[model samples]
Target chain A: MAGEVESIEKFLDEYMPSAELKEVKRLLYGKEIRLLEFPAEAEELAKEKDFELKGYGCDAARESSRLPKIVRIAGVQNKIVLPTSAPVAEQRDAIWAKISEIIRCAAICGVNILCLQEAWTMPFAFCTREKKPWAEFAESAERGPTTKFLQQLAQQYNMVIVSPILERDEDHGDILANTAVIISNTGDVMGKTCKNHIPRVGDFNESTYYMEGNTGHRVFQTQFGKIAVNICYGRHHPQNWMMYGVNGAEIVFNPSATVGALSEPLWPIEARNAAIANSYFVCGINRVGTETFPNEFTSGDGKPAHKDFGHFYGSSYVAAPDGSRTPGLSRTRDGIIIAEVDLNLCRQVKDHWGFRMTQRLDLYAEELADVNKPSWKPNIIN
Target chain B: MAGEVESIEKFLDEYMPSAELKEVKRLLYGKEIRLLEFPAEAEELAKEKDFELKGYGCDAARESSRLPKIVRIAGVQNKIVLPTSAPVAEQRDAIWAKISEIIRCAAICGVNILCLQEAWTMPFAFCTREKKPWAEFAESAERGPTTKFLQQLAQQYNMVIVSPILERDEDHGDILANTAVIISNTGDVMGKTCKNHIPRVGDFNESTYYMEGNTGHRVFQTQFGKIAVNICYGRHHPQNWMMYGVNGAEIVFNPSATVGALSEPLWPIEARNAAIANSYFVCGINRVGTETFPNEFTSGDGKPAHKDFGHFYGSSYVAAPDGSRTPGLSRTRDGIIIAEVDLNLCRQVKDHWGFRMTQRLDLYAEELADVNKPSWKPNIIN
Candidate 1:
């Protein structure tokens, strides 16, 4: 793995200035600006690197001639097609192997920040009502093997990795949370943001296993950009998305594992609204494929009992600050969506549309303070 | 118009138990149940009524055999297809005549609560940047001619009418606000909810004319159902929608005057998200057709100067608490959409989803109270 990382680095360092890179850059910048081309040996080296450099594109924006900055982001929406009812350890191993391949692919494509779907290490088994099999999947945020693997990749590629996992807080007596751990380019654990809103609808009885996030909306000042993670159900809460923008997040990632029946229509709405309302880029990721449990469950809609929790449609896409979005990745297959975003677009959009400047935070603060009161009123009838 | 209203009442009285009405009812309730029908003279009364009932659909759900209450809500998305540069009075009269016809149409369809688009009596001329012509469109929400006319219609049909108007709040020194006057079935003023969020983008430079609402989120308790209006720009704010639900709004209407390029993508997202997140029915209405102002305006997108504000794309639709949504109205024409929604679904969904019960409101209140503070921190890294 270490050797693979070095080869990937060598290929990237060599391929950074090729004519192919320039064409991709031109397509993004909208004008042809000459970029120096690397030697032919770099192409040969990439071929020999054993790293699949699939789907590469570059987007750059220059606020000024000298202040050019770009943030390349990737969303990995994977399917859990492993053998059904496999042992927990075997399931973990199979998932890890698939994730490693995608991470390598993202690194080869020069992604500065990469994000995985919520609880990426395990099947979404909380819906089964059989708690033990799923609870056994929870791991420490700091010492988890998933984190260790992501850290290695993050350091090797000088990339920031957002890994959402089922966290067992050993220090807090094994209290669980749907946590997103940020791994810095230096292979250090930057921090974690917990899932703020837990859905209890139908088969999404996530509260049966984990509690609502104790950590407030935390924006990580990573090497590439300022980023935040609004894990899964938090997307439905506007305030949850607003706080991240309030804390100055340039990009927010929503890593989710929601089924199609429960959230497909909502899938296109929430994250895109968050991006437009907050004036920031949003990368929406979802787990794909169907997962069947040992026992059947009913959705309370008077439907027949079913062992599967519907499809986890993986139509992951990136929405820009200007409310434009990219085409989603495959909904039934494992895939990676890489979007090249100009972080300056966040500033440009904020300036053009003064949603932040004109939000009237004071009014909302006063109103929100009164919402939970016993005698709260929505408005003055008089 | 009074004759039209009386004719509708006679028709409804006669058709209550007709076989045609039974088929529609059975299609909605998902089971065949006999319902008493109106006399045959009702069909003769409709023939003499001289009105057209546009698009209509029935959707109903009953949790049990006993709890059966249905609310039929209609959203009128009218276009200002009158001469674009007509006199202010002429424009007002023309718009009123068109809306009156739609009201009659809605009444004939047996709509219980009828909501018109934002400022339905006036052309959305804030984009023109010409003050006097647009300013003249403002009227007193309590006693304006539009309200008086709607009151008459409300009384004649026994319908709750939601009329969004550009309000001239004379008591407050002629200060203006985007106000929705809720007229009760008995021809009295129920109350008014002002638009809380005002847009300052491009042609939607509404802040220049009106201040943000001080009325906050007001839910009107009418005979048909408890309802609320979030008005146009407020739709982008999730808290705005949530507050109405908190105040026990079974149905929330978003009366809007937005354009295609600016908000078409968002049109489908916000109201549906509101319905699902708040577990209430959301009816979204927008004015139709394109308006050409006298002068050109720039949206800062580096495009050429344009006189028109693009298409309004009047795709009004309704979303249920169960996340199902009706298709939008016509994008290029004036239209009315009637949706038959079971108010019981709101409660049934809340019971199943438990979003309201499980929401950590205290945590959010504390967090929201700090957002405006200068020393607010998203999270403590240590």
Candidate 2:
């Protein structure tokens, strides 16, 4: 039996002939392998020889140049008074003041953006029968107080504001849309996107209050970068976020007002999922506190009933493209959470994960086009 | 104008005719709508009310059962003697004793399964000239001493052992296959899985050593459940894990002896990626210590050189399907980390995230088959 011996250089000469093995050799030579504690004599000898000892450890090569910029974001859970209240004007003023305070505090903390809960200025009024008079609160997007106030605040603090409201299109003669207004820092109304999908089941009587948003996925170019907003209930539909991403949204915001018993764990899941899938940053802003409105009138059937409202648990958070998160704001606390986000991290993640490079977008487009086909049904109640 | 007054009962009569409105009425009647507090008062109320809530800020439905059984897992980073080492029959007994001691200590900590680093019993002899004498270390799947000894200990302690070895088959003589031998608790040779993807890059001269794995992905059914082993470099491939999951592997083990500088961050990324993508538990084990061997000979160029062995970092860890990790076993510490894993959690995650439900497997199969087609390549890459 012959003993075949080969030095490290000989092995590299045979295996990596085309490459500059010297560079790799130079970088690794003489470094201590952190995982092992070598005998002092051996360590000293290795150091004397200038041989680099290598160990298993994390490399910061890809993460080196990327810097995360911290910005505060706030979500206000606004509760609107029922129509049966005596003075709607006075109630509206109080609600606006409360919302202003939230925006002001978020701006003071250097929040680049603040998102209000769904239908921020009003209660979920769609839960009741819609009378013609109830439409009074559904103001024009261009002329509404909510839009005007948010725009002014945007200019005041150099912040972008996303306000989901019952938008009345005056041009269409009182046609209402479930709309989200994006106000730019210069007090300009950049644009508005409507909810593409509306849930017809359960307590979400969204169709009764406003028509589905007509705008396709659109992101506004701001002083910071291109940003997009997906209103509450849209997160359940993954394509909504994807559409925003494909349209070049650097920062995507999901403004929501959901109760505590229904969706907390899913809270962390959604933003992370969106961030990873789209390779973009996701800000999940949830409203805190609770609201109780007065019952309209007595029951026709004489059954006992009382007014009830959702306790919006506030657990706002920001998820990076690689699915890492900064510590989120408390779900129970009514405060702002500021996180530094690096725009470069998106490119870094994309290069590393290669999801965008590997995504079959054309195939998805064809598949989604044929929505009538029967597919795998998961947790289908029907 | 007529003011239409409708009580909550009348509203429910018209809008929620199908709902058991009695439940909602019962929970809300005479109750103040205030924000819920820490211990999840809303959960208690909802449980009593017998109604399910679905939204943000809610706790997931608590499981009726207690926590699942915990098993500690440890990865042994072993250095194989390079093929150039002068064969010494007398050294086998000492080596066996040392390896046995490591396994015994791991078993004492309730480690049901211990995955030895790739080719645990022998050095990566392929680093130099290949000859028939190196085949002496190659072992048979059914009769290897490493397997025989580990099998005995497994039976004694009711443990399952995964031993990766340089394998030799007479029919295909000297064609090495980086393989993992699965030893069942009852001392049976369950089966073995060969490394699927072999890398030809870097210091990995795998092509010179072994043919690609003949067997595709495989999972072994042990007393503990179905387990699968992915060899060192195979961790870089995503489809490897996906195939294991489709074949019903509950726990996937990645046993590696990777050095630090070349690809360290990839260590944490690989295990967690497998766990998250496939919704299965992953145990990543690496060699924690360092090894140095005498240089047998010099290169033809006469540049003085020795066999430069790289240090293997030992940050072994166990990751849950939900992306939560028990603190990782330190790369510097020869220790164990144990955590109870609820197999049911996999189902829970799948149910909530709908990954499996939404996966169009047939389409993916077709796409992957032609992923490298010339037509599919972007012009820029070309």
Candidate 3:
């Protein structure tokens, strides 16, 4: 028996090259072997085959790790209008019908989550100084028709809905808040996150109409995953996205109603930046089409028909965790953008890149905290 | 005079529609104001021009805020390769001449910073790991001929030079480090940021030849602005770029010697991510052309020529802070890419987007520092 074994070994050694030894080892050991061997004459023949096998193994492994999970999201770019000459009742009915149409279509598309542009049930009223009548549209979050409609739709379609609206706290009386409601598929109110930053410039005379949000940053837990919303103009601020990411949001939405000229360039920059920095997918929805509203006020210089209301140019898009964007559904057409997002991609990217892991956050906190101080101004002028 | 003004306004109001009044305002303030009040209509226009402007007096009394000075910068992608297989002494001479030629040409084209491909002075030696005698081509960082030659060229042309090389740290007993050095225009050793991450898979076997970098994140201060280097495989890590940005780097260079098939895809992804996330300009330099060495190492598994060397497909490019890349400098041509980048663009972006000001550093720190056990394991059996 020993002679027979020796003869077999001699025959293998004579024919096999040292290079093929590792492959032969793998055949004997099943899948456990790290190295292998083969016959000298077989070396040339095995090269192409070995690479092909390795490529196949890698592809299979990547595919298995990347199991696809489909997610549907919907957004409404509130094109609600309030004609200066029209009564509040007439305006409200017109806007509500438009919003209802949006919600119905979103439900039909099988969206699990639907978000509306900032204050979806009303026109952007912060563009002028006229206050009292405009403020009348604001109501209690739970009592508002926008929330009631969205909540009913969530139950009807078994989907989570995000309703952004102007909230008038009856208890607080004077202060209005820009609030968003996170409703469950079962129509239960999950939570709410308010817009933290309010712009005080240009057409955004938000300070005249509403106070800055005081809810602090918050994320909602849902059946799909942890999610958060940064409403409209809040997308301009990176902290809004960062707050959600730190709180464990895997998906964040930036629901906005902005014009093409004023905010188009910012679209590509902000969404991708938020995605790459936080390692989370971002769904950005902008209102499509134009809304015409009658001018109610003149400029301080007594100029008639001072500023025609701006157009809400919609070009909504979704950015993946890898900072790549899917071709948008449309800016003009009200539609949903469906994508297969693997939550695992976030983990894989963060593990490999370690943006969050290696960041020296301590230094940034101390330095950036004082950057806006009056004393921090540099002498150099632009 | 007041009665005349009131009478004219009343007459206009009685005769013109509100839309016509809107057109009058545009005529007064629009770009075509001259056409609205033509000289033929009134030589009285010349008399009105002499009247003192309302805001002009205040503007004259108040000194204008000094504008920030703008400096134009040009980033050059130098696709370079040293003849490594040639006799060592002859190879060193050829490289020195090549370095001088490149610097002179780049300076003539008005490039502010010329970044060469990673380890341009030596061929990549990690293909098979046999440790041939020629592998000693990797030199000490402080005394390397490549570093010395570039330093001389920097002083000669008064240009900032970024040189990446296979560094053997003499102070650390010749410990190898993949390093990139940023030399000031005056030839001062500004600083060096060693590549922190070493890729272990695919065509990248860098860890086999060099250990991970020990230098804490660093940025070099120069006449142009703050600059940093992400050497070769380090570009794969977004945190590496973030570190540079947090340290106040305005321009970052990704010097890479990557091949066509494996790395070309990563090329578009990595640089754009770095630029968008950090809001800083990125210059990506890649080596061009196919390089074949004298010997091939068979796989330990007795497979024929297990490692077929890679072709360095050079698609060098410069990405603006907004993530827009200039048409890539040709991979085929060994030439300089020059673009006048306004340094003021960084400040303009920061002011507009407010990314740094709005970042929530405290929250990110806590999340990243939490080293909880992972929830999943590597899928090895796929």
Candidate 4:
């Protein structure tokens, strides 16, 4: 029996090999989100940049009344360009250069939108939990140098960019937030949504830095489609995904960072479940490579302190509303996954599945209210 | 990439083969749900009974404060015996006999709880859309012939049996429900929870015979542990699974009947996602084999009427609280899956993950209220 399985082969095997996947493109995902021909120069660009690049298509049966609104979205996963030994600005800038190559590739493939891994500009340093130079990485989301750089790339590429970062909220007492900033193709900082749930598990305790997001589920309506960002830990919460779908997001991106083995089993499950339940396109991007921090940190589990988080495992991919998905990128490498999806398929799936129509939200809302009472009791029958 | 994949190899590849899987038992899932030695005679019994029998174990570290509450749960997936051509009594009797062998096997294996596939005693004739003969399968939850038979078996085996069936409510104008009847090990009729979400997709639409359940998530307190049932279509609804978790269920059973390809991609994802999100053990049992109906029906998708609902694709398995799971049963065979779980792992995982602690129920309750309002707008940034 497959109990607590360890083989890397099993994780990669969840997705089909390229050749066989095409034959079953019509298996599900409402009207069959077909696999399109690979983008020209995809492998060449991947080989040149030393990063894995893969793409899939989510299509709809064109109706006479509704033109298929095809929107291409790209997700990138990469390690910190230079170690924490480098100056913060220089380190962030190195990532800027590394990510720029992927952004240009996304542009070459005509991506309408692109998303980066959580806190992409800096080393995932929350494991150290020290307050000095690490806090310096937090910046104002609106004016952050990372967001500004992405705005230029967005304008240069004529594409929307979602940049997840550690936001030092300037107006609100300068408290920090784990946030995703949305930059429009027109080079405007459209809006930002904070990461609602922060990790307290293992050494990934961001509560040492930021609290739960103050902002509710926020969906951004861009020229291409309606989208939302459920940062990192928020993917574990079904309601977080539910609210974004409730708000009519056609596509939801899970910009996440977690070590391998710790979460590899969960990686392929959650975002796909969200996509299936919410009837939306979902992109899951994770940070690649393990980084050795300048200082050692303890997980408080009686284990010796360590300097490095495990590999981030960069098997990012896209899932369509009909539950069909693209194969993940290499788990051991920096990579870019681009999926072109039709926004109309979201509504078509909702129409066919009738989940949104029959979701019984009122029943849950009433029960949740009852659960909140001080005298609340579980619905357990003895 | 893996877009709309069709090959059988891909799905089976998601699980590691036995020899390799045992190596990394502690990868995640808290303390790691280990694969224990197979029940004595498991292989021989499987061969003799002509069914697949597999088992895994979930263990926790020995603590000074509490003794381990080792509970063995079993899930069975099988087709209706003797066909609909036999009288309802004969059909039900044949099932009772076939299941008796498994019940005896569960007793030998010392299974604390056993759950059968959805509508196990019938031909899954909802696709026929006919009222006569099929409706005869609906029996009272408390006095249903199937439940009564299982009650006797439960007492005989000192086991709790979860029987999912077409329920004919005697007090409610003979209204039908897709329900799970919980019978205690001592032969008492404990309680029943109806299937909340009736699917409208494809030929699995139970709305043709029954409406959505009125009984909210009800967790039954058995001698072994607290358990609940999330019926077939309810697995598609995250809230349905969430409510069961909220009701303090230690183990949640999903007794489902779905055809291959229709939901093969989603089968391994949902229940496991629930177990991870809710910090509970989950058992997912799916009906095996295809059942051809007495008549043809159209899905209204412009295809000609069909007589069968494709393949049920039995791949029942158990998922532990920390996201590890047993390999699913053979997709083509009748089988039973047994997992020995220490319920304490649920709390240990919740402590380690803190998902339930940070779930923020009030926020969702408040937002869900707004969602119900006619003038409510999604928090969309244009």
Chain A TM-score values, per prediction: 0.84, 0.73, 0.74, 0.92
Models sorted by lDDT, best on top: 4, 1, 3, 2
Off by over 4 Å in 4: A1-45, B1-45
Off by over 4 Å in 1: A1-62, A65-68, A81-84, A294-306, A377-382, B1-60, B294-307, B377-382
C-alpha lDDT of all candidate models, in order: 0.75, 0.57, 0.58, 0.84
lDDT of 3 at B183: 78
Interface RMSD of each: 14.3, 22.0, 24.1, 5.2
Compose the digit string of candidate 2's lDDT tens values, residues B1-382: 0221211223333433232333222222211112212225534433443322111111123576745534444555433332334463433455565566656555544567767767766555444444455557777777877788888988997888888887876457646678899888788888888887675533455667777686666678676657888887767655556667766777788887776654553455556656765767777877655554444433233545557435566666666565554334444433333434546666665655444554444444433333335464311100
Task: Give native contacts recovered, as a fraction, per prediction.
Answer: 0.35, 0.00, 0.02, 0.68
* Decreasing DockQ order of the candidates: 4, 1, 3, 2
Candidate 4 structure quality by residue, lDDT tens digits, A1-382: 3332223434434444544433333332223444455556766777887987777777786878999898899899998888897898889889889888888888888899999999988999998888778788889999978888888999988999999998999999999889999999999999999988888998887999999997899899999999999999999999899999999999999999988757877887899999999999999998888799888888778989888987787778898888887767766688888888888989888988888988999998898999999999999999
TM-score of chain B of each: 0.85, 0.74, 0.75, 0.92
TM-score of each: 0.84, 0.52, 0.69, 0.93
Model 3, chain A: how large is the TM-score?
0.74
Q: Report how far off residue A206 is in candidate 4 (Å).
A: 0.4
Give TM-score, chain B, model 1.
Answer: 0.85
